[model samples]
Target: MRLTAEQIASFHEDGFLVLQDWFTPDEVDLLRTETYHEFGNDQPGRILEKNGAVRTVFAAHKSNDVFSRLTRLQKMAEPAAQLLGDEVYVHQFKINAKLGLDGDQWEWHQDYLYWLKEDAMPTPNVLSAVVFLNTVDDFNGPLLLIPGSQKMGTIDLDVEKKYQQLDVAESWKPTLTADLKYKISKRTLIRALENSRIVAAKGTPGFVVFFHGNTLHASAGNLSPVDRLSVFISYNTVANALQPIANPRPTFISERDFTPIAALPDDALLAPRNGHSSPQREQLASLAG
Candidate 1:
C-alpha cells in the first residue's frame, strides 16, 4: 500500500492522485451493499440533497463494521500519514449517494476551509480519500478538481449568514455554530483559478482518489439516469487535531475524536461477512432477537 516516491510527488504537484481498482470488484460489491443498507435508514446525519435525495450518510463507521474498518485501512491511512508526516485520525466519514436528476450540486469548496474555520485545525495536514462505489462518468456528476489549487493555500471566503440546520436556540451556543457552516465558492477566486485545469475524474467502482485538504473541488448536479455513489474518509494528522472553536457542526459532520488511527492489515477488508458476524453485526442480531 506504500505509494512510490514518484506517485507521492505527483500528488503533491497536482493536488490529487487517482488509483484505479484500488478495491477489487468483490470488495466493491460488499461495500456497495452496505452503502445501500445505510441509504435505507432515515436518521440524523443522513443529509439530503436540495432535491431530497440523500446527499450523504455520515459516521457510518460507528454503526457498521465494514465502514469502521475502512476508516483505518492501511492503504488509505498510510498516504495521509506520509503526506502529513504524522500519525492520523478520522476527521469525518461519509457515504455520498448522488441519485440521478435529484442530486444537487456541491458548491466549490476546500475541505481544510471547513476544518480550519469550524474545527480550528491549525494546518492543512488533512486529506480526503474517496472510493467510488459506482460507475462515475462526466455526465453523472464526477468530482471536478482544480489542479495545483492546494498550493495557493486556504482562501478567505465571503461567508453568508449561517443558515440554521436545527430549530433550536439561535443565540444558545452548541459545540457547532452556524457561523462556521460551509460557505459558497468565492467567484473571484474561481475566476482566478480559471487558468488551472479542472480534472473530471471518471472511473468504475473501486477506484480511489486522494486529494489535498485545500484542493478546490466541486461536483455538478447529477442530471443523468445513473447514480453516483462514493465514500469519503477524511484523515487529519494527530499533531494537527483541533483547538477549541465556536459552535461546530454535529459530531457526525466533524468528529471530535483525536485518537491516532492504527492501520489494519491489507487483507483486513477481505474477510467474508457471511461466514462470521462482525461486532456490530452481533449487536444487531442481539437487538433483533
Candidate 2:
C-alpha cells in the first residue's frame, strides 16, 4: 500500500495512477455479491437506477460489512491516506454499475465543479479510489482520463459549456472554431511531460485506480452484454470545509444530505443542505435503523 516515489509522482503529475491486482479474487467476489444482493432486494433507499445502477450515499462507518472491510484494507487506505496526508474520512462510497447495454454516457466534468457555487471557499482535501469489481475492457466501456487535467484547477464555466454542447451533439466531428477551442482548452490542462492516452486498463477484478478530484474523466456507453461494475470510495481530509445545499426532491443521497468534501482556493462549490427530510430521506433512514 505504500506508494513508491515513482507511483506518487505519476499520480501528482498525471492526475491518476493504476494499481494492478490490488484486490484479491475473493474480495472482489464478496463485494460484487453484496452489491448485487443489495441492489436486487431493494433494501429501502439503496439502489437508484434510471439508466444504470447508482447507489446513494452511506456513511463509511455505517455501510455493510463487505464495504467496511474493503475500506479497512491497508492496500486501499494507505494510498488514500498518503494523498490526503494521514487523517482523512471516507466522504462518500457507493457501487456504480454500468450495464453493458445502452446506459447514458457521462459528461466530461470535474468532480468538484458542482461545489463552486455562489460564495464558498475551496479546500484541497480530496481524492478518489475506484476498485474495479469486474474486469473492465473497452467492450464494457472503461474510464477515460485527461492526464494532468487536475492541475488546470477548476475548468472555466464558459469553456465547460462548450464541451457540454459538443458532448450533447455527439459530435466528435467539430467545426473549425469548435476544434480550435477544444484543443486550446485541452492543452492548457495536460502536462507537457505526459502523453494523453485513453486508459484501456484491463486488470483483475481487484485492481484499483486513484485519481485527483479535479481530474477530467469520461466513460463511453456500455455496449457489451455483461455489466461493468466498480466500487468507488471518495476520501477527504478532515480539514476540508463542508457546506450543505438545499434539495427539495432528491433521487440520490448525495443530492440530499451529503456535504461537499473538497475544493480549491478561491472557488465556490455547493454543499448539501442540512436539516432536510423527504420521502427519499425517509427511505434511506432504514440504513440507520
Candidate 3:
C-alpha cells in the first residue's frame, strides 16, 4: 500500500507511524505459529525465561524462517526504500515474545544509545519495524512512544548526569546494577514529557509499526495470560555503514556492534557493504527458527 502524505508527515513529525493491518491475516498466523513452535521446542540451544506467568524466548538471525521472512518482506522493504531513498540493508532482527502475566517492562530509550561509543555523531539512516504477531494492550504491555523525541538526537552526557542526580534524590534504583541506570534515565526522560501516551495497538495481527532509530519507546510489564509477540527488524540505508566496536561500557552487556557487509554474490538477496554479522542477529535467527 502507498503511504499518504499525511502518514509520511506524521512519521516525520513524530518519528513513528503505526499502520493498521499492514500484513495479511494469513501471514500473521503463519509467523505466530512458527514462533510458538520454535519456542516450545527450544531449537538452536536458546534459553526460555518465565517470570511468574509470563514466558519469553529469544533467537538470532540465520537460524529461523520468521526472521528470514521479516527481513525479506516487501511491505517492509518498500517503505524503507522510500524513507532511505536508496537500497537498504538489515542491521538486526529479532522476535520478542512475552507470554502470560509476568513479562518485564522495557525502559524508554533511544536504541542507538546502546550502540554509541565515546562521542560520535549518531547515524541518521537507521529505522526499525516492529511487527505485532499478536494483539497488544495495557495488560500485555503495549509499546509507548514519545512523539518528536527522535529530533532530540542522542542523549547528552550532561543530561544523563542530571538524570543520575534525580535518580539518587528520589532514591530510585530501577535495576540492580549501574548498567541498567542508563535505561532508567531514559524512562525518567520520557516520564517528563507532558503529552506521552500508551500506544493503543491491539487487535488484528500483522500490524507493522515503524519508528526512527532514535525514537524514545518502551513497554510496561505484561499482566495477561495471552501472549504478546513482536518481530523487530532494524534497517539502514546503503549510504550509511555500520561500524564495529568492542564494548566500552564498564558493566556487562548483551548487545554487540554491527558491521557492514564486505561483499555480495550475484545471488545474494541483500547487497553487500563492508561489515559482518553481529551476535544479536545470530540470536534472532535462533529464536525465529
User: How well is each residue in 1-289 modelled by candidate 3, as lDDT tens digits?
Assistant: 4477897788888888899877777667767876777666544323334332323344444566445545655567667666656666675565666666655667666766654532121476678888898877767888788787777776743335644565332322222112334553645574547565445555567788888877887777678997888877777765664444342321112223333223222112222223457664554336434
lDDT of each: 0.79, 0.58, 0.60
TM-score of 3: 0.70
For 23-97, candidate 1 gives per-residue lDDT tens digits of 988889888989999998898878765556787788999889899878777788888788777999989999988
Most TM-score-accurate candidate: 1
Q: Which residue pairs clash within candidate 1?
A: 175-248, 176-247, 176-248, 177-247, 177-248
- Give candidate 2 regions above 4 Å deviation: 41-61, 116-121, 158-197, 244-289
Q: What ranking of all candidate models by lDDT puts the best one first?
A: 1, 3, 2
Candidates sorted on TM-score, descending: 1, 3, 2
Model 1 — TM-score against the truth?
0.86
In model 2, the Cα lDDT at residue 115 comes to: 35
Q: Per-residue lDDT of 1-289 in model 2, one digit per residue for the tens?
A: 4889899889998888999987667667767787776566554345444544553323332446556546545566667878767555565566666766844454455655543331131564577799888888877878778777787787644444654565432322221111222222454434422656545556768788898878877677678987888877777655664555343212222222233222111100111124466654443334323
Q: Regarding TM-score, does 1 or 2 come out ahead? A: 1
What is the C-alpha local distance difference test score of candidate 3? 0.60
lDDT of 1: 0.79
